[model samples]
Target: MKKEFRSGCPISSTLDVIGDKWSLLIIRDMLIKHKKTFKEISDSDESIAPSILSARLKLLESYKLISKIKIPKNKKENIYLLTEKGIRLTPIIIEFSLWGDTNMREFNKIKDVKGLNLDKSYIIQSVQDHYNSMLLNF
Candidate 1:
């Protein structure tokens, strides 16, 4: 579906495409946690409803952020992978992690967000590289 922006502002436009309760979480599942199947993503800690998961997956696909493929052996199962566009959001996700680790830890009960001591660039590249490697197996 073509996205309708609320304003011409870049941030607003970006939000139009991804600013939702569930969109980024879906992205996070695929990018950070390597969740590919519908069941895997739905079983996340957030416990997103199946209906909302379906809608967010479609929205992400409509924006070219993810691509879906059927398992070769099991045609009934699907694996959702992030596209280049979606992988580009890795840095943003990393930033959010850092922000939450630093600021929201107390209220959120986050004991620690791993790799806080490591270089941000290294972490980002590692995540993107992992995704790229996964692509080669398909």
Candidate 2:
């Protein structure tokens, strides 16, 4: 069984849903690159197993972070899409990607992002604004 999340703090609650390394990576794959199908997710260089990816998708869906829909062209296969909650994570994911590109020898692309001195406050505000826009559009 999955561990229960702490409820009082919103940050804690947010982490409870996606604190795991895989979950965030999955979210990154979806939000950053707009990967939709299970095949695309499984094909990630991260090499996540299908079963683990399935479980993570289920968990994110349960938390209302993402949803799946059948593609009109290929109705048999489902494409996972981020809900408002998932879209709200955009800036944070970008920041983490920026951090990884800077510190990790493997991720060198962030030199530009770091050089730009991406504003953390601006990212946070963007996320809030994006979520607000999503909610209102509904």
- Report the number of the highest-TM-score candidate: 1
| Model 1 CA RMSD to the hidden true structure, in angstroms | 1.1
Candidate 1 local lDDT, 30-130, one digit each (tens): 99888999999999888999999998899899889999999889999998999999999999898888888888978877867578779999999999998
| Tens digits of lDDT, candidate 2, 41-132 | 88887899989999999999988889888888887999888888788787778778666766784644333443325577776675556545
lDDT for predicted candidate 1 compared with the true structure = 0.90
Model 1: ten consecutive residues of lowest lDDT:
108-117
Cα lDDT computed for each candidate against the true fold: 0.90, 0.77
Which is the leading candidate under lDDT?
A: 1
Clashing pairs in 2: none
How many pairs of residues in model 1 come into backbone collision?
0
Report per-prediction Cα RMSD to one decimal: 1.1, 4.5
Question: Model 1: runs farther than 4 Å from truth?
Answer: none
Give the least accurate 10-residue stretch of model 2, judged by summed lDDT: 107-116
